[model samples]
Target: MSPTPIAWQAETVPVAGIALHLARAGAGAPVLVLHHDIGRPEPSPFDDALARSFSVLAPSHPGYDKSPRPDWMRSVRDVAVVYQWLLGERELTRDLTLVGLGFGGWIAAEMATMAPRAFKRLVLVGAMGIKPERGEIADQALLSYIDYVRRGFADQRAFDRLFGAEPTTAQLEQWDLNREMTFRIAWKPYMYGATLPHLLGGVATPALVVWGREDRIVPLECGERYAKSLPRARLAIVEGAGHFVDMEKPDELAQLVIRFVNEA
Candidate 1:
């Protein structure tokens, strides 16, 4: 297979007096994508698909990847505020879309709650923020990087296709960085907020809460919780996917977002 072409223009924009490294691509309205615990690499098929219809902007949350995490940044809420500031800096107070994946979902939920009307549409895919009534959220700290990522896909081949059967040294190092950041912000409570569920009510933006039927990471019940709490949200499922729906089924996920956000 040939090497994937560049999909985004790398840029560093300052928000709230701090610099944010982000990838910007395509054209049209903005779709602010908040990534999961693991920082996503560029040239994603899902992002590219979105780029075809709207501008795709993905930022490395502070303390992850190349971004400089400030000492004041302690919780997911802090990250959310930075993103909200990014929108304000760009004059995207409203008339914009927000998509969050896994851990990013926690950040997105907080942002939407802080200013519900700021986003016109919201999509949370296999998000982790609320505690489940039945099962527990998977504890990634207890597993190796490979083991943790393996749980995200229903199909092992999909994992091999994306991260290789054996990840490289550089990849492993990046995984460590991701783990460190995840621990910094999402620890103690272990990938959840006690008040997130209670605060989700009355959001003005329409939301699409998607989950993988086979997800062993964050249980499907959490998705239901998100749907139930958000006044204008619907729950959707990808049959064979796990927590990493975008990695396992990018096109399907993209299609879901497009259809939901396009609806009158």
Candidate 2:
């Protein structure tokens, strides 16, 4: 038989008065896939792997990718509220398996902390939310594309295949837009908000905290602290990986998620 095609679709839904673009795949229980700060809701290997077992719903958070952005949208918490609205509009309030990556993971944590009962489970991969007591926060916006590619990947060959060529004109334009919006909201504090730590302890959902052992952006210790604070949480460190652990170790991450959600 021919290969079974991945049934993926894209559309816009109204969230916080702005239309947010969402890409979806598969058919089953709903799993929301949140993208990293410098990434969009594209068909990443990690997303593809997860889609094999879940109805994956990946949305370009308000100002990222092609989503419409309003001037009023500011701070990571605002992004979380938009996602909450997105789930409400789509009728995905209950039984949500939220998988957030990098900055998206921060948004996921905020969402879960805000409404602990809404999500059944949460998976944060290389998440950035909790403050590091010692190390200075890494400014992602200041890094060159090559710098990002190197820091995010453990395998150079895989990096060449995924982000090798210079970005296309359209991609460059979108990148510019994403960078502008990211700076507008997240530049002031560098890594986290003042009140995020206080809010994190309130989350009641089962959490799977995945960290890249070599992550430079959000240190592994942050993941340890995040897991320690949550009532039901486990921390998994992916070896030979950096900030983008999901991209570098998709299969391993997928297995962890499958096991966590399946058990719950």
Candidate 3:
């Protein structure tokens, strides 16, 4: 397959009394992508695939990266609400698709529960929100920022591909900013949402819950619970992949998402 030349260009978009650093590309129906705790400062292969079929909107969540954080915003739900306004302003609710990964997945899930029928389809990849019935979600606060990131990949080579064995000082600093923001918003509850599962019951959006088979951070049980809670949801486990599927198996993961989003 020929590589796509599509690339994201960051721009400042003012919405809901905040200026968001948004990266946009592609053309077609809208797909709003929510980044993880570390933020997707660069485009993922998954996003590139989606751009072939949809207009992609990837904005830095408030307080992460270039996006300014307000003192008032303190929860994942708050971030979800901000994106809702961004969708409203852009008139993207017409035929929208929502995709969130890890922390961003938590935000996407919150938004889906909040406005159940707003999106055409929902995709949550190795999302962190609900507490697992069996095992505990890995504590990001306890580990070094790099260690936390390393824990997401299935193996060392995958980790090195995204963030090399010896990441530059700039890369480390970026992760530092992201970690602080995550600590600020998700500290009290860690990563899981206490009432998120209960709230998901009424969400009518068709959700595709994708989890890496080798994910060791967020337990697989959380994905199972999410699939069980939503009115219309199914779970897909990608073999040999870890929590960071975008890094470990971007093309394969993208295909799964594309097929799900295109489903009738």
What RMSD does each model have against the real structure? Answer: 1.7, 2.0, 1.3
Q: Write the per-residue lDDT of candidate 3 for residues 1-264, one digit (tens) a residue.
A: 779578787899897677999988899878888888887846477788788888888889998888987767788888888888888888888689899998899999999988999889999998999987788889977888788888898887978877789878988888888888888889878898899988998898899999999888898888998889988999999999888887788888778877888777
- Candidates in order, TM-scores: namely 0.96, 0.93, 0.96
Q: If both were scored by lDDT, which would come out higher, candidate 2 or candidate 3?
A: 3
Off by over 4 Å in 2: 1-5, 165-170
Better of 1 and 2 by TM-score: 1
Go through the candidates in order and give the clash count of each. 0, 0, 0
In model 2, how large is the Cα lDDT of residue 236? 89
For model 1, state the Cα shift of residue 41 in Å: 3.1
Q: Per-residue alpha-carbon lDDT of model 1 for 138-163, expressed as tens digits?
A: 99889999999999899999989988
Candidate 2: residue 238 lDDT (0-100):
87
Any idea what lDDT model 1 has? Answer: 0.88
Report every candidate's CA lDDT.
0.88, 0.81, 0.86
**How well does candidate 3 score on lDDT at residue 213?**
91
Instruction: Estimate the overall C-alpha local distance difference test score of candidate 2.
Output: 0.81
Better of 2 and 3 by TM-score: 3
- Output the lDDT of residue 52, model 3: 84
lDDT-based ranking, best first? 1, 3, 2
